[model samples]
Target: MSKVYSTQELIEILAQERRSCMNGQRLNLAASVSGNPVIDRFLKPEGIQKFSAYNDFKAAVHSYQRQHQVSGIIWCELTMKGKTLRYPAIDEQLAALDSDLKILKAAKADLLEFWYTGIQGMDLYLSINFGKDYQKIMPNDVKEVAQKTEWANLYEYKNYNFWEIILQLGWGKPEEASYKRGWPKSGSEYIHAVNPGKCPIC
Candidate 1:
């Protein structure tokens, strides 16, 4: 049997893992090992099991998804140090930008969720699902929003900010979706390796 962890619990676990990493700089949750006490709890065939390495942990996750036929939670770390755009600031700036474009109100696109996980520095988790509305909300729209938004704090790395809204896994077919080394690229890395012919939104 597998234990189900709530989204908040997962976030906390991810935060703890982030803090344990190299000053939260190389915190890749998907590629992380099962050293965290909480990892086994989220795994199926549930009994306290230890994965010796990240490959073991990854294999377990893939196995669980294959057995359940569902897409597992994918955490994409958006920014390591969101000097001006952390949590409420990011929400506020995005809200203001949305007000102008009426993007959310248009009922065409989804920004998904944003989480402000404060580590030794600062990190923000931004999840955007441009599935159905990929036609209406072009990738440029996200860049424009990020460009137009005002930073609450003084930040110098605005040029480094990029939206990971280019491609999404074919969620409808989770069974076939293989776990690549990095499917959803993280931290300002634009997804440039999508198959246009296979990807509906690519």
Candidate 2:
């Protein structure tokens, strides 16, 4: 029988994986805000005019991941037509982006729960679906789990310090879950409250 872990177990597993991959090196909090030049190319004003579709965004992320030899988490914040959007779940967004970019190899979706057990912290659970392709290089089961199990949900704790993507899995449903359970009251509040300081971004 296949091994199935609980949500908390999955979170601990992913967190350990993240720590191992980092080699104990602390991640730069500003890396996401600084943005990748390749990513910035598509996100800039002119680039936005040229590549406005979500597929384009996905392509840029895939390309960036390939070149950097890094994988795990990705975060995006954007404004279009005076409407602003912040993507807290980096893995899910990337999965959707991969589909849009036609790069999705294997796709899967499951409910995931996230919680923060710290003062001035946050605790909420939500569902997240994950997908991946692996460029046709890795083993089947490895790719399957990599695409499906590797991802983290986003939580904005404080201003200008949004927590980047972190890895989590096997999230079960909460008693009082809703479609809009964990979202903040406003964009400003989201930016202020969701910081990496409060959450792990691996």
Candidate 3:
């Protein structure tokens, strides 16, 4: 007989498998269950959508819940790729991003993409892509808030890359977007922007 697992247990199992098999990318639990007869029957295309950004995904989830009277936890697989840092190091970045995201969401920044990229022997970096609405905010304020939010904390021996942040601008999604700023130069050294909110969306 097969061993039964609780919902949380199954989620944990899937997450572990994704880390191992998918090069540290988080498992998209919803997409994983998509097309299953039972799931499709309940959550048809009209009831579910996919978004590359957490803010948009969250807003959609809440809207669906309110309209359908559904009651359940909202869950999504957050992508985290790069060298493994200590648990505290990871937690710190999460906490910082959470704080900053809340502020950005309230400002209606319309985030389009948020992710980390890099791996062992590579420079780990955090990136945020925003829609055109981001331009309403003051550039300096955007820089100040994001820098304090621990924008890049992948490695301990912090340096130029540690202070670097990419601010991408466009509509729909980052990949489909046509605007981005090259790395900025601070003093005499080349560095990326301090935060994405400062980027002008086209």
Which candidate tops TM-score?
Answer: 1
Residue pairs clashing, model 3: none
lDDT of 3: 0.31
Candidate 1 lDDT tens digits, 1-202: 7676543443354445434442433333444335666874575321212222322433444454345443233322334335322211111101122232232223212222221121222222222342222233334443454443322111112224332223221211122222422244311212221223222222
RMSD in Å for model 1? 16.4
lDDT, model 2, position 71: 39
> Cα RMSD to native, each candidate?
16.4, 19.4, 15.4
Candidate 3 residue lDDT tens string, 2-82: 554433443344445434434423323354336679767776342232222232434444354344433322222223344
Candidate 2 segments whose C-alpha is farther than 4 A from its true place: 1-58, 72-116, 119-150, 157-202
TM-score to native of every candidate shown: 0.22, 0.21, 0.20
In candidate 2, residue 156 scores what lDDT?
31
Model 1 bad stretches (over 4 Å): 1-3, 14-52, 58-202
Q: Going through the candidates in order, what is the number of backbone clashes in each?
A: 0, 13, 0
lDDT of 2: 0.31
Model 3: residue 80 alpha-carbon error in angstroms: 22
Per-residue C-alpha lDDT of model 2 across residues 23-51, encoded as one tens digit per residue: 52333332232257876765534333332
Stretches of model 3 off by over 4 angstroms after superposition: 1-14, 20-162, 173-191, 194-202
